[model samples]
Target: MKIGVLALQGDFDAHRKRLEELGAEVVLVKKPEQLDDIAGLVIPGGESSTFLNLLGKEGFAKLKGFVRMKPTFGTCAGAILLANEVENPKQVGLGALDITIRRNAYGRQVDSSIREGQFLHDPIEMVFIRAPKIERLGKDVEVVATEGRDPVMVRKGNTLAATFHPELSDDSRIHQYFLDLVTNGKH
Candidate 1:
């Protein structure tokens, strides 16, 4: 199967490398048209507002459409983009995932750190950098991982979002889980 990583900004290369390491054909998607060829998409961590400016109107519309139909995994700023509501200065989102996110809720960039979070009942390393916090989640959303009482990673249908950057860590489970969702067509 093929996976496309959003290359408009941020550390998209890291996501590309991780997906490639898992034996999937990876595409650094720089254009909205690229969305048509990939089975799944990975939106890497970046400035959410910057992504909006870069995507413009047509590209944003294309992305909004793609995420609704295809399996899409988003991390950090990507998570913000996927949320239904954004705070700490409201912003429009794709509404792909039923959750409310607060930008930089974990604190400033200097406060970034590595911590252990529970994933599928097992402890996993999570890297949070200027991360958004999942404030409120809709009933359909499942908490896939958590740091303390906060939902760091969540899933609902074909949309999976992580407030932390899974690609930044050594763990393959998170990415693998996303791949599984794509492979099984299990939302």
Candidate 2:
């Protein structure tokens, strides 16, 4: 199956590399039109506001429609984009997942750190760099993983959002889970 990584900014290439390692065709989507052929999409971490400005209104509209019909996995800032509510309140997002996110809740870039946490069946190393924290989850959302008391991974139907950068580490289970959602037509 083909998976497109939103290549506007951030660590999109890392996600693409990991997807390829899992034996899936990867596409770097720079334009809205590039989204058409992919079965799934991955939105990488970056500055949420900058990514929104880059998307513009038209790009955001198109992405909103795309996620509604396809399986999507969003990481860090990408997760911020998918959230229904942004904590700062000034930033606009795709609002695909019914959750509220507080940007840089883990403190600033200098405060970033790595921690071992329970995400899935095994322990996963979580890298938090100016990461957002999930404030609340709607009834439809399910928590997949957590870092201490904070919810790090969440899912709602075909949409999955993680506040940490799973791709930054060597684990591909999260990506693999997303691929399964695409292949099984779970969306």
Each candidate's TM vs. the true structure? Answer: 0.98, 0.96
lDDT of 1 by residue, 1-187 (tens): 8899999999999998888899999999989999999999999999999999999999999999999999999999999999989999999999999899999997897999999989987999999999999999999899989999888999999899999999999889999999999999773
Predicted structure with the largest lDDT when compared to the true one: 1
The alpha-carbon deviation from the true structure for residue 185 of candidate 2, after best TM-score superposition, in angstroms, is: 3.4
Estimate the TM-score for candidate 1: 0.98
Give the alpha carbon lDDT tens digit for every residue of 39-69 in model 2: 9999999888888988988899999999999
Worst 10 residues of 1 by lDDT: 178-187
lDDT of each: 0.93, 0.90
Q: Model 1 Cα displacement at 24 (Å)?
A: 0.5
